[model samples]
Target: MKKTLTVLIAAGALLGAAGCSATPQLTNEETCARVKTVVSAQSATSDKAGMTRVANQLRPIKAAASEDLRDPLQTIIEYFDEAAKPTPDTAKLEDMKADYSAAGQTYGQVCGTGQ
Candidate 1:
């Protein structure tokens, strides 16, 4: 009974880890920006492992961002030579910002600056 219970607990932990590892959708700009930030942070930090820890902590922030190609009005005109399409669910952007901020806090806790 003790062995069976331990196995069940271990299996549950593995399943939970697998489920948590699923990647959230992110926008192209967000991905690029985050990658750039991580790379820059890596270069600036002396501890490679520590920098990696910080980057990993911030992954969800980048994942939570969207890349649906919506831009501010002027930037949209500059890129597509027309107005950018309006997003129906703009609140997600705010959520993404909050996620990023939380990630920043996590990074700061772990890496001292969170970049």
Candidate 2:
């Protein structure tokens, strides 16, 4: 019960943070934009099922977007993993690679990527 509540709260907090809001940590726009981009890219490649799976997997981990790099990056990688019956988009994948690189660089320089 405790764990479930914690997860629910985290999901709600993250969902709220993604919408337009003034989260003291970082603006929701920043995190939400990244998540939107990732989801859009996956949808462009795979079927609805794949997109849904990624979205479902991402909901709980979504909180990491506003705080750290590792969790978001890991979530993005999970999206990549969930993609099915679709080929990778080289250009979009390149952009994702750069985003992941940014997160990794941040992790290397700052704390452990907000983990």
Candidate 3:
């Protein structure tokens, strides 16, 4: 759980992700902007609750995101979902960090962020 909040905050801070079910297909720029807006508006509080919320919020964005963003968003969602579990598997969490980092880098590239 210690690592959960850390990764959550890192992902949120770096990517600032989200989208809605009602959202239409978005251009890459629009998707990036929407993600930043959604995440900034709802800052995570507790580890489990926050990670779960983040995962839930990101699913729709993944569905509507540009092709370049789909894989990264899916990876991020998987990270958050694993972190939100009551007893996150340490080995899994350890293995996931590299992928999460890669996803964050992908997000930054796609969104044109320095992060």
For all candidates in order, the CA lDDT equals 0.47, 0.56, 0.83
Off by over 4 Å in 1: 26-61, 66-115
RMSD of each: 14.5, 13.7, 18.3
Off by over 4 Å in 3: 1-24
lDDT of 3 by residue, 36-87 (tens): 7666655654578887887788888888998888888899889989988999
TM-score list, all predictions: 0.26, 0.32, 0.74
The sequence of per-residue lDDT tens digits that candidate 2 reaches over residues 1-115 is 9999999999999998889574244334555565555555645445646655655655544654556654645745554654432675566666677666665565444433353
> How does model 3 fare in lDDT?
0.83
RMSD (Cα, Å) of candidate 2? 13.7
Backbone clash pairs for candidate 1 read 27-67
User: Model 1, clash count?
Assistant: 1
Between the candidate structures 1 and 2, which one is better when assessed by lDDT?
A: 2
Per-residue lDDT tens digits for candidate 1, residues 27-76, read 55554465447557644353544544544544455446444322221121
In candidate 2, how many Å is residue 115 off?
Answer: 14
